[model samples]
Target: MTVVFAALAVSRHLQDATGVSIQNLVRTLRTVRSATIRLGRHEITLALDIPAAAQAILDRLPPRGH
Candidate 1:
């Protein structure tokens, strides 16, 4: 869950930088594996499975032609 939250934070940053929606970014990604965060000299790593995460995001989106 923390990994997912971290990924969402990255997505939000990307959205702000590129003006692309998170949904669109996920939809277009061919691979999204993991995220790493560093604090001081330590690093935190989280693994993410691409298909599962993408599907989770897709499931939350409203259906097309709304």
Candidate 2:
């Protein structure tokens, strides 16, 4: 699924069709942030680490300035 997302992220046709910049997709994938909330007297939070699948996709990408 991460590979599929990465492929879609880099697809010019998809970008043109959706008007979504690849930069934004890559940014979104790279920085999947955690969330926090408070309810009544309790606090709840979610901490997310980059999925191994996503990391693999990212690792295969060419470095910037390539």
Q: Number of the top candidate by TM-score?
A: 1
TM-score versus the correct structure, for each prediction = 0.38, 0.33
- The superposed Cα distance between candidate 2 and the true structure at residue 32, in angstroms, equals 2.6
Model 2 C-alpha lDDT per residue in residues 1-66, reported as the tens digit of each score: 999987866676535644556675466566656888999999999877787655655565566766
Backbone clashes in each candidate structure, one number apiece? 0, 0
Off by over 4 Å in 1: 31-66
Q: Choose the strongest candidate by lDDT.
A: 1
The parts of candidate 2 lying over 4 Å away from their true place are: 1-9, 12-31, 34-48
For candidate 1, the clash count comes to: 0
Q: Supply candidate 2's per-residue lDDT for 26.
A: 62
lDDT of 1: 0.69
Task: Write one digit per residue (lDDT tens) for candidate 1, span 1-66.
Answer: 999999988778667654558777666555766889999999999977667655655555556655
Report the Cα RMSD per candidate: 13.0, 10.7
- Model 2: number of clashes? 0
